[model samples]
Target: MAQIAVFFLFLAVIQASVALKCKVCDDTDGSCSKLRDETCPAGASDREAACLIHIYKDATTKKEMTEKKCVNRFKNTGKYDCIENPNNQQIKCYTCVEDFCNEKNSATKLGLFGIVSLVLSILVSKIL
Candidate 1:
């Protein structure tokens, strides 16, 4: 009886840790207006717990291109790869953990560093 209870407990833990669902698309602006949601595959690591968006730009024409997909979360240091060009092809990647987070452009959102900086500035001003 004890062994059966333990087995059921383990199953509960696995069920509780089910994978995430995120918007999957590759639009010019990273919006999911016309895209669908996908569940992150099982066995995905913690790093892959977030949705990612990659934006690219054409150096000469200034045309913007974007790609949205599931990606691992960034750790202590940046974790992305891009092509290099002497011209001006710019590439930027963003990651968010919330459901359908990649549906909209996150450039308008304040990042962790920005929030921390704002708090520190307010505190310093109060002190001074």
Candidate 2:
């Protein structure tokens, strides 16, 4: 029983840690495209806006994933305007998976629950 309790505690800690690191990928509104040109003037290119690019590991490994930059070409200008790149392709804005979080919500919930439980236990024991 003690072992089970310890295991649960460990699992909870891990879950909380994961939650604290969770971050939603936001690659919209030309954010990821900025990585390509950063200063391309309007009408310089004609590429569709790419918000998020997936990085595959070893061409076959599904366990590992990363983000890349999505570029949008400007129409009539024949130029490219670079924006934010989530894929870490650009040397200036490369991001590793370790830099992001995956389970922030869970971690917050766990923390709140832990605090509330501790307070309640203390209050009940005092009343008893």
Top-TM-score structure, candidate number:
1
Report lDDT (CA) for all predictions: 0.57, 0.34
lDDT of 1 by residue, 1-128 (tens): 44544454455444435565666773444333467788765332434466667666757778666666666654444354444465756577677655566777773432334345445555555555
Query: Poorest 10 consecutive residues of model 1 by lDDT?
Result: 107-116
**Listing every candidate in turn, what is its Cα RMSD in Å to the true structure after a full C-alpha superposition?**
12.1, 17.1
In Å, residue 55's CA in model 2 sits off its true spot by: 21
Evaluate model 2: give its TM-score.
0.23
Cα lDDT for residue 76, candidate 1? 44
Residue 124 shift from truth in candidate 2, angstroms: 0.7
Provide the global lDDT of candidate 1 against the true structure: 0.57
Q: Model 2, residue 7: what's the lDDT?
A: 51
lDDT of 2 by residue, 65-100 (tens): 334433344434424443533443432222211212
